[model samples]
Target: MSLIAAASFFGWLVGPLAGGYLAQYGAAMAFQVAAVAVFLCMIFVATVIKETHKVSNEQSFLSLFKSNNSLTLLSHPNILNLFVLQFFSVLV
Candidate 1:
């Protein structure tokens, strides 16, 4: 998890610097490069990834949304606090 976080932080820092270099070619070239990257990523995920989590027969995926389960989860104190903090941070 820490590795993922550190890599994500570095990617965010590096992406714009790399994009700026790509942008010198043309605005359209930058977008074209991004599109190809996304296409390669899609292919990689489709071929290499497998479902790891087991689903139970008793529970339907939509059960959370079918009842008030989602609303109840949102009303949890920790989640509610996180939402409030996020809202205020975004406002700033």
Candidate 2:
């Protein structure tokens, strides 16, 4: 799973350089190819991917970012405090 994730990220990372070169060569099919490649990625995720956690429910995007779920013992509180303090310090 980790390897697959890494490879997917690597492909995304290099995609623009490859596509730009292909477009300069006037292959014209370059954008279509990239779109198809993305579609194929969706298929791969649907069929081959499994949840990493043993038990996990998918969360909504807004809820994921907005949740107070980060309040915590190991790391969250002071980190958030420092972050908020930085924001105020910058504004002041």
RMSD for each of the candidates: 4.0, 5.5
Indicate the worst ten consecutive residues by lDDT in candidate 1: 64-73
Please tell me which predicted candidate would have the highest lDDT against the true structure: 1
lDDT of 2: 0.79
- For all candidates in order, the CA lDDT equals 0.82, 0.79
Cα lDDT of model 2 by residue, 23-61, tens digit: 876766788888898899899998899878672768887
Candidate 1 at 5: error in angstroms? Answer: 1.7
Per residue, candidate 1 scores C-alpha lDDT tens digits across 1-92 of 99989978987987788789998899888788878877997899889998788755576668745764655766689998888899899999
Q: List pairs with backbone clashes in candidate 2.
A: none
Q: Give the 10-residue window scoring lowest on summed lDDT in candidate 2.
A: 65-74
TM-score per candidate, in order? 0.59, 0.50
lDDT (C-alpha) at residue 17 in model 2: 74
Error of 1 at 59 (Å): 7.0
lDDT of 2 at 45: 94
